[model samples]
Target: MGLKSFLSRPLAAYTVRQYQQWTRQPELAQQRILQTLVRQGRATAFGRDHGLGGVRNAQEFQQRVPVRDYEGLSPYFDRVKQGESSVLWPGQPLYLAKTSGTTSGTKYIPITKDSIGNHINGAKDALLHYVHASGKPQFLDGKLMFLSGSPELEEVGGIKTGRLSGISNHHVPAYLRRNQLPSYPTNIIEDWEQKLDRVVDETLDQPMTLISGIPPWVQMYFDRITQRTGRPVGEVFPAFQLFVYGGVNFEPYRRKLLESIGRTVDTVELFPASEGFFAFQDEPHNPGMLLLADAGIYYEFIPAEQFYEPNPPRLTLAEVELDRNYALVVSSNAGLWGYSVGDTVRFVSLRPHRVVVTGRIKHFLSAFGEHVIGEEVEQTLREALQQFPEAEVVEFTVAPRVSEAETEPSRHEWLVEFARPPQDLAAFAAALDAGLRRRNVYYDDLLAGNILAPLLLTPLPAGAFQRYMRSQGKLGGQNKVPRLSNDRALAGGLLSVG
Candidate 1:
């Protein structure tokens, strides 16, 4: 073993043990976190305005501070933007993580000194866990690459501001930073297409032991390399053994990614975001990510089915049950109080509090009362792929196309871009319909009653979705096409481009 791996093993073992100890008492740890947050919040301007002076527990906190998204809390954020101290947190924030989403146009999330460790250490601990479990830590020896946002940050109110990935770029540990790839100049290129070409040029022949990014962008990089060299990524870089991915589920892009690799490589899943790092896959076989209970963030859950209800029951970790979908709400040291992160998660294991990202709170197909979420669609597609091994999807989205006639019912429209189109399109569509019926009862019911016809599958030409994103100026590592939407806007957009 090299000095790095040799030293990492013992440290990994100790860290994992310590983490396991706290995970065993999740509620206790969370309660302690709540107390700290409440104590510190009393000193903030927003907290004082929200009647947080007497808040002692969850109920009181909830009553004093209602759940708010970016728009609802923009008043306080505006103050922070103008360099106001003690607006949200005690002092001025260390950085502002600027992110753009489909719903919230642009949001500047604060990341303070108290919360920065969660962002950095969460990633480090995940890799260390892999080092301990896999027992093959040579990934540290070669060039470790994180295809992320630019390290070039602009100043906002005397605070560094940029994408969360970019903010993370500035804080990579020195040991790994020495081995990071694509050079600083290549990463700062604003145009994704140009940056990707430069990335291909710089790392085509390097010893890439690990490649980390959102899945779609990583697939794009692999495509570029294979197109140039006529060799699979595995052959191109024999040392590449680990792929770390976040921001989206990996299953939709998994088959194509593995085919490009031409071999199996271990993967690690993370649940990091600009708000805070929430979870990471702790065990090799466990599909669910272990929730970071002791981190600077305090987590709450609202049942997903009732998310739109006026007063939904908010539950703590101890009150949560298994296999139920819930919207994630969090209070953190970053000055976000009762903040809705807009993510839906399902708990698969309560003992260690492991969760799977079900979907986005707003990104669903509920137009016809058949609320089909992200995880369901992704899983259904995975099943459908089994029947047609020749077909590999590049990207896809679903939206309901309502009928103009009163008697004629609408159908779900599926716009799929394939890396390799299936030979029999009708057969592929039937397979998808069958799989979705097995997973979602409401969608199945609609078909049974003739309220909805079989989903229409439009095999889009390759690069169609990428073109749409480019047109919107959102083609990059940080942006992705929504898996499914409720309205015809995205569907119309995709069809218009094709």
Candidate 2:
């Protein structure tokens, strides 16, 4: 079945166009989607009781149903966990993808047939864009490798526990199954001891062309493969052309990968999640432009200034402006309505409606980029960390400092809280300086002079993040430590470095 899906390019392209047409009609799409959500709510007994039955338009629906976070849907998620699809969908859900959020034990994201199609379409769109740009219909003609956690689907003991990647593998279409390199069969969750080794063994001699996954996992794969084969990665996998990565910033990790491969490989960024696939780099040459999958989502944008507004303008895809940064608010067929995924993005061009993901509003830092967010920093930080893993940061924060005197330079001050205490502070700082150079050329040149000082590493007192979370009445559950710092007082109170 998987092999059939892999080989049926014409059928795949037909399905892709069907998905794209949904987004092309901005006005009609909104009307149809609004009606569907209301109908779904009525069918599920939510609309009549709440008197939300008459939500005739998107605007009216938004007004009637206040925006809700995952915390607000705990009761609904719990019902799905008990194998009841009452609040999530109409029938028995196919599976639940486990996720950790700021205020829960674990979020059982219901993966229904409708939701699964959304994910598949999103992934297919990424591939379609690549094929269109490269003019390579047989892009997946060779071994296409994905370094996911594991392929285990159903779990016993009434618990759905595993990485999101593991759960997704079960729903892969039958036709595209052959494209997966069958090197490893062990469940990563069950066989944590040998997972990495198995991965190395599987791809050692394979002619892998397209590689995709998190930077850490991919980088680790390179290290293991190089050590096992006694050859550079380029020699081991000569067919590799496109490298797709996401989940964290690539800036910090890029230099190490380039050095290891000894050449620049084509790279693309994928903006996706277990809940849904949001966007992807549309053009190889232009990393900034991410074309929205209009068909799968009813798009909305909350301008950065109005992000916290009670009723921000939830612009349709047609209403979106070019070059303006806004947080994404989307309503999808997969049971998410008026939901903000917390990602911030800007339009590069709007004629084709392409966007550039700027940052996560929740993870913004006040620094060189006023709106500096996780994706940007992650890109640079990953490149840096690959070179100096010893400089692993347990926590970090950055703040803007005013030049007290004319002689002082205007710059952003970073207070890095490292995991391991370094014996030589200067050496630790210089290592970071070198790592940044490799990740971003501009940063490297800035550090060469006094423009940006070598980073200041402050070994934090162990358990600071845990202690801070406890103080906030947020302990003993999933929590996100602050990734970016603009609030000086909050940063100082929460963090202390030796």
Candidate 3:
């Protein structure tokens, strides 16, 4: 038998046991977790801040701490990175994981040693999930390629240089000193510079079996690999068995990726962050499971429907009801408490706490499984509009709908309001369609046939999102334009009729 089958066979018993426990006794599992977090909170920064928030302990955690978005902790996060104790949390944090924010900047999120342990635990769980699903440890053993932000530390020797690169330098993990592969270059890029070269050098003649990174990079890497090898990836590297990815949706690029690989390759979806590894797919086919790191974090769920509601019910990770959609709330060793990560999720089942990542609660879009998140869509649109000397995004909203009810499958429509209407709307829309198709195959297929009609960019009046913000009386503090909204209603009633 090949390595994958061999490894999987031995681990079958353990995987089944964990699966049973995960699928059964979810309530008891939650209660057990609640008791653990109550104790951890008392020892961590979140517990200390709870008193100020009027939460004396875990029993009163809900009452004491209110839900918070990332903008709420920006200042405190800055302080924590400077090695200062933050008012938002209990203690002095050790390191910061630099990550890009939705707005026009990168964020240095605090990551304590305790939270780092959580990250490792999350990583182990990731391994367990792969082993369980594929029944193989060889996929874990071979040379692993991580297309992630570099592990380089920012220097504080003298004059401080500030740029996206410099900010990224600060977020390198302390443990990277001992953990990273020796062959991978020590110097890495701030904006994916030298990406193609680095990938070629590190992977060539290497025993790489699994690859992990953001979806775009992976797609790009595969494309480059195919070009260099002059054949599909299967011919270049037959040993490759698994592709693990996170930080962005994989559904969009699924088809092209499968075609490039030229065979069925196991995939694992990881939900990770600079803050910590949150959740991972427990089984390959059953969406992702929110395996509670009872020892690491305090998780809370706010219903997606009530996300913008002034008074939404915030359910602790353990108390969370299954088969319902909710916004993820996190409290960890990092100074964030009751913080909303912005991603929205729906529970698939509870015994093992499996969930489907529905969309981002903030600026994001998911029309017909394209999963066009804010940053990704923004990047694509920015690149496409660069060609249009006068084109500017005044505002835009994507809504999933039935373009033609008579059609067997409904398609998507993006209602976009431009700052300066494009000189050629058809060309502009076609550019976006091309980018989306190249980036994701599902959309490509949808467009090739009429499953999804040609993307229609409906221009709206200027100041759309801004107008919605004003009407909601939510303008100015730290709000960004919503990228996607359910077709039921205009997001925050932000769309102006064209």
Candidate 4:
């Protein structure tokens, strides 16, 4: 047997066993994770300050550590950035993953030894689940190309700082590193356009079996490959059988991506944040991903409707209900105690604990009390796009247009950049408007009452969003366009572009 094939067997078996055990007793697994984190971090400043040393159970832990967001944890992060050891996690973090901030300039999320281990193990389990479910072990035999951020890092207060993918790239196992595409030098190119060119050149002829990345970036790669080779992606990489994606909902991009691939391929969705690796799609037909209960991260859920409450009730895995949107909170090995990651999710299944990412807590529109979310907008767009098969949406954002005078009507403004323009722009807008009203009762009521005008659709010139991201110094990596904003900052910026 080949070395990789031989090694994968035992690893796959262990992952299957672990997944079964954790899913079968999710509450027990989570409790054990919570206990481990509290015990391990008891010596840290945060641990002592929060009295984590005496916290023996989930209830006690919850009572001790109040739920916090990035702003709430900023004080401790400031200490960590100044090289403070044992401030949040034990000892110093190896690196800090920099994420785009809403108010602050940036968010520095710690990456400790234990947390990195969780990241690696969670990724492994995701793949093993895919293999086990599909009964396809040959996937390990070929190269797996991951289009991610550069591995090149900058030192901040003697700690490495860069994109999470870049940080994780530095620790790729020797055996598996050989199977991953895009050389180290190419990954660190910094210029996304140039980096993509190099990636395409390097992997054009490789025996690629798996491809993983954010959907938008992956679609860009597929488009470039097809353009250069004068052949579809399936023809270029017939061995490519799986496409793993996360960071954004796949619904809007699914049709265009499938058209690029020119054939059906297995897909796996992951819910990974700078905070932690939380879940992965395990079953082939399941829309929700199975939550990773034993990934060294304690999970908590607060209803999205109550996220802004002064003291919202926090629910553990056992308490989370199916089909209810909840804002996720995590206390992990990374030393983020009761940290809100800003994402919202709804449980699809309670038996094995699976969830679908509904939207971000901050990325919703509620100007007219309609309370439209990212999921709703994306689904509405997806249904709208079906009417115009030739039109492909590359990027989009929405914002409320409040009236300047009492006589003026308020409406929702949509800025959409399309790779392929539609034949009838007005029809596209009409379809989107109808879809939203049908999906949201509040929106329907507002429109029926004439309190809001028909949604406005502005087709942006190609590369408008990209230019904006570049101008903002957030062109690549995990940075994405805010899908829905209650304010006009993002919308105005996009509209200002020629």
Candidate 5:
């Protein structure tokens, strides 16, 4: 038997057991996770200060701890960075996962020993679940490539520090490491362009069966490979069967990626952040990802509309309703206590609790009091693209263009880089404007009242956003273009790149 087959027997059994507990008894599993976190952390400074010692249940835990963002937890992080122990968790973190400053500025998230276990195990279960669902026990025999950040970690205040991908690489198990591609030397190359070139060169001839990475970077890899080999990805690696991706919405890139591959492959989406691995596409056919309720994190959801309120209502899994946007909060083994990861989500299923990430809390255009979210903008583009079937959007960003004088009205400005330019630019823009108005009531009202002009569309040269991100040294791996911004800073920067 092959290595994968030998390992699958036990892994499959374990996955089945865990799946039952998660789906059949979600509340009980969540309660156990909460009690474990509280009991283990009760001795820490954060625990004592937040009355974790007395937090015996979910209700008590909620009443004691207030929801906070990275800024709110900065004071505690500052102390932890200075080499303090037992501040948030039982001891100092194993390393700090330095997140991409795409949304807010850079954040150093704690990655405790316990937290890393959750990440590793959660990933394992996701893959195992895929194997179980597909009934493809030999999926692991062929080479698997993870196009991720550098594995070379640097020391910051005596603690190891690097991107979350790098940190996870440091902990990759020996058995799985044998099947993973692009040697360790190639992984540690800090320069993204240099690393991509090397990875393409090294992995082109391998029997790659599975690939995982953020969509944009994976698209870049596919482009490079096609250029180098003069063949479609599936033609180069016929054994390739699965594509695992996360960190960004897959809608815009879905058609492009599938076209590049030249065949339909099984896909699994993940919701992993610096704080924790929160959810994964458990079933291949399911639309929403199954939340990892027992994955060492206690989750809370606040209605997106009330997220900015002084004291927003925090709801547990049972309290959340379907189709309502919510800002997710978590208390985890990673030392993040009631921390808002900043992304918003909507529940599609309540029984097993599946969710789809809607957008970022800070990524919205509300310059003219017409709040436009990422979901609305993306859906609008999707509709607009449908009208121009030949066109494909490479990347896009939206910002407000405020009036320079009273004669003009403020309007939403879109900078879109298309791989395949539409036949009619004006029609595409009109479709986008109409679609946006249809999606958002406030935007419709503003258009009707003449408070805001029709949305402006500017076609950017291809690779504009890529060039901008490269200049910012955030070209790949959890770094993405902010879809909606209140100001023109990002849009201006991308336009300035000739």
Candidate 6:
């Protein structure tokens, strides 16, 4: 091994050792962070208004602060965006991550110097954890491709503002700069299709070993490269070994992604957001991510079922039980307090507090009170796929449909695009419907009572979802289709193109 590779393993081992200090006793780590956050919050305008100065414990903090969504917190956010200091956190924020919101329009999430450490470290440690466990550091020797947003950032209120991925691009470790792929000009193209074309041209001949992106976007890159070279991605670049991804569920696209590569590779799953980098998968064999409890963010949870109620209990890490769904909440050094990040998670292990992202608190099927969630839909679809190996899903979404005739539209319409269509369409639909009923008790009750018809599958032409995403200007870079909806907005859009 060369100097860098020789040094990396020891460094990784040391890093993993340091990480254990927190994960092994997250309750202590979390308590320390919460106390620090309270100290910081006491100096801000929001803290004073919320009576945070007198808070001495988690119970007091919980009672003092009410849970807030973006809209509820936007008043304080407005002051920060307009160049005010000490509005939320102490002093001015270093950056404001711009993200699209379904209800709040555009959101400007603060990224303080302190909070930025959480993002930068989580990403670096993800690789370090892999090196420490696998003892393979040569993946760093070859070109690493991170399919992401433009690095070009604009100024808002004297703070750098851009998409989170673009902001993160600026911080790829200096040692890895030479190993990173897709020229700067190619990344800043903005238009995703153009960027993909340029990325393909630039990386076609390079020795790419690590490729990273949201699944569908990376799959698109693989498709274009394979089409051009008439070979599997692994053949085109045999050095390729690590696949890093986040932003959405990876299982749905796993089959197609593997098929395109023609080989298995190491995959790391990340739970990231504009708010904070919450967790990352350490062990590839398991389906859970190690929660970043001490990374300048204090976590709290409200049982997912009680989340919509008037006053939901905010439970600490020590109080959370395993295998139960909870709406994940956070109070961070970024100046966001009692922030409901719209994500729901289930604890798989409490020893180190590993969690699986179950679904969004808002993204569910409840028009007829069926309460079907993303996890249920995705899991049901996976079971159905196993029953019919000939069928392959490219993309899919579920939306409720309203109809006058009982024989008309099915209550839950599943819009799907297939890479390999099933020969027995009726049988496939029956399997999916049955699997869903088995998973969701609410859906099963509705179906049995005849209050709702069985789910229906509407397969579209190949690349229809791609066309839809492209038309909506959300083709790539941290965007994914909402998996389940109570309304027909997404369903209507899909039907128009299908």
Q: Write the per-residue lDDT of candidate 4 for residues 263-310, one digit (tens) a residue.
A: 999998988888999998988788989998888889999999888988
The window of 10 residues in a row where model 2 has the poorest summed lDDT is: 473-482
Candidate 4 Cα misplacement greater than 4 A, ranges: 1-3
Pairs of colliding residues, candidate 4: none
Which RMSD does model 4 reach against the true structure? Answer: 1.7
lDDT of each: 0.91, 0.62, 0.61, 0.89, 0.88, 0.91
The worst-scoring run of ten residues by lDDT in candidate 6 lies at 402-411
Candidate 1 at 421: error in angstroms? Answer: 2.0
Give the CA lDDT, 0 to 100, for residue 409 in model 6.
54
Per-candidate TM equals: 0.98, 0.73, 0.66, 0.96, 0.97, 0.98
In order, what is each prediction's RMSD in angstroms?
1.1, 7.6, 11.3, 1.7, 1.5, 1.0
Please provide, for model 6 over 33-63, each residue's C-alpha lDDT reduced to its tens digit, 9 standing for 90 to 100: 9889999889899999998889999999989
* TM match of model 2 to true structure: 0.73
Off by over 4 Å in 5: 102-104
lDDT of 3 at 452: 74
Candidate 6, superposed: residue stretches over 4 Å from native: 406-410
Question: Number of the top candidate by lDDT?
Answer: 1
- Model 4 TM-score is 0.96
Question: Who is ahead in TM-score, 5 or 6?
Answer: 6
Candidate 1 lDDT over residue span 310-366, tens digit each: 999899999999999999999999999999999999999988899999889989898
Query: For model 1, how many clashes?
Result: 0
Tens digits of per-residue lDDT, candidate 3, 44-128, equal 4545655543444454777777777767766555555555553434555455555557552666666665665666656556666
Ranking, TM-score, top scorer first: 6, 1, 5, 4, 2, 3
Of 1 and 3, the candidate ahead on TM-score is: 1
